[model samples]
Target: MTDTAPQPIDLDALPEEDDHDEALTTFRARVGAFELHWSVDAPLSVVMTSSSHVGRAGVGLIEVLTSAEQRGRTSQAYWRSAVGERLRVQGSHITSDGGAERAVIVQTDAVSGLEVRSTVTAPRGTTALRIESVVRNAGREPVVLTAVSSATIGIGRSSSDLDRVTWGSAASEWLAEDRWRETPVRELLPDISLPFHGQDGRGHAGVTSHGAWSSGEHLPCGYLVRGDGEALAWQIETSAGWHADLSQTRNGGVLSLLGPTDLEHQFAHELLPGESFTAVPVAIAASAEARDGVIAGLTRYRRWLRRDVAGEALPVVYNDFMNTLMGQPTTEQLLPLIRGAAAAGAEVFCIDAGWFADPAIGDWWSTVGEWREATARFGEGGLRRVIDEIHRQGMSSGLWLEPEVVGVDSPAAARLPDEAFFQRFGRRVQEDRRYHLDFRHPAVRGHLDATVDHLVEEYGIRYLKLDYNINPGAGTERNATTAGDGLLAHTRAFQDWLVRVQQRHPSLRIENCSSGAMRADYALLSVTHLQSTSDQQDFLLYPPIAASAPASILPEQCGNWAYPSSEMSDDETAFTLVTGLSGRLYLSGFLEELRPAQRDRVAEAVALHKALRGELADATPFWPLGLPAWDAPTVCLGLRTGSGDLLFVWDRDAAPAAFTLPDVSGEVEVLFPAAPTDGSGWRLATTVAGLSVATSAGLGARVLKVRRG
Candidate 1:
């Protein structure tokens, strides 16, 4: 925590020599709990490894692709490029980022005039290293970069170790999000016995995201572990395209993380003379203690990255969207919901989509712009009346907005010029009959800024639910060399615009919802107040998502939806409430239509959340039964806080049985189902190492408070 910056120690044994000599000079620097080794030689090689790691071998420092020098080896592809091996080390130094120590290494390729300054950052008190590269064209001519790596590090010491490794990452969809997959490394990459042939393998196994929805298909976080359980987990923090992979090299097996490339995402960046391009930020957390430990380290880093979040400054929100209005909102439907939400202790009431739609205008699906209130919907006063009702109920009002797209038939589509929209090949990019707006264009930014200001100023809103529905493949060709480059620019501009909007309304809270986590990357979370975890309507399917989301997102930012309807039994209603209690507790469903007991259940859950939210904000998440599977019968999540810890367990479709929680012996009580005579037979008792949970069978859940003695 001291202001004294870290110094890089020279570990090279050889004496000083000219750059022309074949002699090697190596240096080391300790960043947080990790060590980085920099070797200055013919081909500059840098290895970032856990300080406690048994091996120090790793791949080259940089893997870059230029228009002239493509892949050096078909076998190495993204792992090995001609320019990467030709770049000679210029210098290495230490720097500081917000008081935390960092290291920057400089390398240059004279032929291409690509000067790369790779910066390594260690967030204080976390075992993660944030890596980035800034490539400047120092030559007299321009250089087109087809690809560049933010981080390339060895994950294995030898071929045998590579085969024995295991890896896992989360796969996501609209309703089914954060489904984790773990498998043997051999399944993804086959060992070609490189030592016998003295060659690096050409083929690689990797995950690449295209289009604007960064997490639409797969999350940008993953991990690799060897047989002894030494593990490394990483996350690429970008809202646009990203790539990460594992491949074989002469030195060892390396994991290369990058943001957008010509070969994959149709991304190309042209750096003119004296100009520079910075690669996306990627981070890695290593743990000698393995999978769970590295995941914990990654969680801690995610926390440190967004420590200035203002979500806790806001109040719990109740939106009439999931399993309720479903976008068909009117005066009759909303007044009752608003009253019920307020009665159930919701501090903010959000009216989801369709508020501005005039059903008389041909269903108004593709004509949703204008943000004007529909007079026919609310008896002349329209949305203002609804907003008034929300205010009268003593709750702040919020609205849902898909700010990045304009319906093709909307007046905005014609008002904004073609330059404001994303266009490729002389045509606007239209997906699902909606045109994606390029945030890089000033007109687009102006329109969104005006829309946000009008909504906040007119309605006096305290919260905004910003949603993105379309994934415009690649990006526009208006102001960039490639589609990927344009996407990168637009994403950056969008985040900047978000910052400006927050500045305009300092007390306002923003929620990032991309059709439910299709774009839940850190670029948005780092700026926005909260993230909608998923759009999953079924309560039966949300436990796994809520349980596993802490691996990549902070528990405080997870916006798990809880919609309890009159159709659900008392136990069923309580089950969904537990899911909401796990995270930010986004409430929904028809509370006004429920019976008195059902309303009491909702009220009790909301009350408990308000009491424990202070703890949830600073707590660290852990799994008692490990991370849950999609259909796992029993799922348990524990939150360790400065105050007594909290444990959440779900008996999904399992018969009434007993399960054990590890390393958690304490005074335990069911915070929910506070009254024991409710006939659920759920009891938490102390065991030798932890607690024994025996709950009533046939789909039930519990919220238990644990005070360790």
Candidate 2:
């Protein structure tokens, strides 16, 4: 007789029992292909699991124990998973036997899988639970798979009034058998059709418009929209591309797909049957607080999650005001720019990319090792003078440093032989105009520390813009042993260096940029202040780029505006300025190039932004009204403050038509300027109970700042 012990078919098929009868809510079981355990404490639960086939071949085994919870009031959830060989639990927190709780493990059963482990302690007032899962492949065939342990929350009802559904193009067609139909959410207010482009080419279609709710057949994710009120939801989906999908009932939230939209980061493997893989998916829930609360909660939880796995800080928005180095900048020219920006209300004046030495520009790269300014550029005591000037302007001074990059012909490169650099193939590879520095070396860390220390102690530099301009080489093909994992190791090590450096200089802000969008992960966000969305400084592209930014990225972190450039029109420029007002504003254009009227317009816009800064930072973008057309006019509407009661409208064209503010009630104040050119020149239209009329006639722009009376 065959020994049939009823083996589990899949890891999730494992039976779990809720022991509410016990003093501690405990759950322990050996599921189909793995072992799992969980316990709950009010709002949170603790879990632990162990499995050998949890990843691909040559990948290490995964032993993770974590705490998961649904936070109350805040409308957020929390998760902290620690990965290692052994899982040890003490009360609510879990750690590895070696106490290396924050380590990340790469596992492969038949294919590659990554597991990041960490611990989560309950927040000050919340109750908590512990949950853990061990997933393994008990089959003989290699399997390419994406596995995620997810917790979903459904508030109120799950029907049409509370939930709505939409499908991607592929998913929509597949569901056509069921007569899947789509309606525009903006139809109720036809005058406010949102101008947006969906993936592929089809515009957004509301799948639940007929007051119905449905789920995606293949994807396990879904959406819910409240009927009378607003609805907000967040989901972390893992496929070939890891993405965090944040959507709401009123407007389409953000779908932040990792890597590039065109490129696929597939977690493929030839699974040898019994091999298993695990992906951690994080989901959070909250009431309708304009989604800002959701973003804040998620930001907090992500920070906590990353801290548990890696003891580092995430990036923050450290705005820089300087332009890129097509050429060198003298202290005299740079100082005035910094001072002017400070006077213009910039908190941080960053001296951008060109501050360092580059031989191509007639000046030899001098500061790569010294971290001091080249005297020839400043005439005397360059860096200190610049720093002092920034302080005098009542703003923080920041300097850009690409520490991981070394110019091949630089003196620093000549002094440090091939051993100190990362080599590809046989010869030392060069990406762009620089060679990579091996941060894994202790000597390298020491050098970076010293360089940062000099800037902090000598010049009172409080912000550092660290730009990684190159990609990683083939680890295995580049060098044997752990050197193959240099990309991973360097990232981890660089984070460590950041933590240590920040500890020594607690006030210093660090912004990370890898040619722009690269290296923007939860791991890096924890340690730095901001991540550059792109290298291109064209304001024309800011709207689309910003529209794509996920809610996970705080309004403050969005890199919206660069500088005062002439490439864009006054209306286009105004649009860009308005978009940037919602995020960290960085200036890059030369003020000297602006015409008198343009300068005045720029100054007024900046002042207006300052006045409405709080509202712009706090409000959520509903739908974009259309872009300005050559024939007709265009307007952009946004809700500002007052729990959906206030509205802000921007007339983007020379000729403005009447705009009906949507869903606004009570007495409201409408503000617009008589002379659009005058910063302080405004004409107070009537204070109306519901809606008001405003007009614009000339080529400039107009802003209607409406507030509930």
> What alpha-carbon RMSD in Å does predicted model 2 have with respect to the real structure?
13.4
Q: Where does candidate 1 clash, by residue pair?
A: 75-202
**Model 1 alpha-carbon drift over 4 Å, by segment:** 1-24, 42-58, 96-98, 678-680, 688-690
Q: How many pairs of residues in model 2 come into backbone collision?
A: 66
lDDT of 2 by residue, 143-226 (tens): 333223233122221112213322221111111111111223333212222223211111222211000001111121222233
Error at 697, model 1, angstroms? 2.8
RMSD of each: 3.0, 13.4
lDDT of 1 by residue, 1-709 (tens): 3333334344352223323232334445666666655455444444444332322433565788888778767754477678886777677676556646777778898788889988877887777878888999999998899888877776655677776778888888888888888888788777667888888788888888858989989998988877787888899989988999778755457788889999789999898999999899888888876777788788888877776655565478999999998988889899999999999999999988887887567466687667777778777677888898999999999998888889999999999999998889888999988998999898988888888898899889888898998899998887999888999999999999998998889878999988899999988888887889899988999999998888778888888899999999988999999999988889999999998999999999999999988877777787878778999989988888886778888888757878888888878878885665656477667878678877776789888888877
Who wins the lDDT comparison? 1
TM-score on alpha carbons, each prediction: 0.94, 0.58
Error of 2 at 367 (Å): 10
Error of 2 at 557 (Å): 2.3
Query: What's model 1's lDDT at 635?
Result: 90
Provide the lowest-lDDT 10-residue window in model 1: 13-22
